[model samples]
Target: MSKETETMKHNAEVAQFRFALIAPVIQGLFPDASATAYYKRVSAAPLMLPEGTSVKYSYKTLENGNPCTAPEGLIH
Candidate 1:
């Protein structure tokens, strides 16, 4: 694949991984009392990516997922 194609492929994989990580929060699948606690708990933990690397998502990234479930009083 071309360099640009490779980059796009990686980015698409990353986006899918991110959505999988935050799917519950976005879909209200978890039973957290509020979004804040959920974000805090999740942000506190490390996430493993497809490349076998570990990372932690920032509050802003998680908050920006679903427009309906963000800011206001959910995340800072």
Candidate 2:
């Protein structure tokens, strides 16, 4: 495969792995929640971050699938 194709494949694999890691948690939190709705809510929620910081923020998924800023760089 070409380098670009290989890179794309790797990215796709990583995305799938990330989804796998989070899917169970999302399911457990919102047993009846639709994936589309859950993602929409998550995307709309404000990320908790330090003021005046332009850092890349990480989020923790709440019981309702809401995304909250992780504390101390720890995933909730």
Query: Among these predicted structures, which one has the highest lDDT?
Result: 1
**lDDT (Cα, tens digit) per residue for candidate 1, span 1-76:** 9999999998888778767656787788867787766767777878788778998877656766645765443222
For each candidate, the alpha-carbon lDDT, in order, equals 0.71, 0.45
Question: Ten residues in a row with the worst lDDT in model 1?
Answer: 67-76
Off by over 4 Å in 1: 51-53, 70-76
Q: Which candidate has the highest TM-score of all? A: 1
TM-score of 2: 0.38
lDDT of 2 by residue, 1-76 (tens): 9999988887776555445534654456644355545544544545433233333223333323323322322232
TM-score of 1: 0.63
Candidate 2 ranges with C-alpha deviation above 4 Å: 29-76
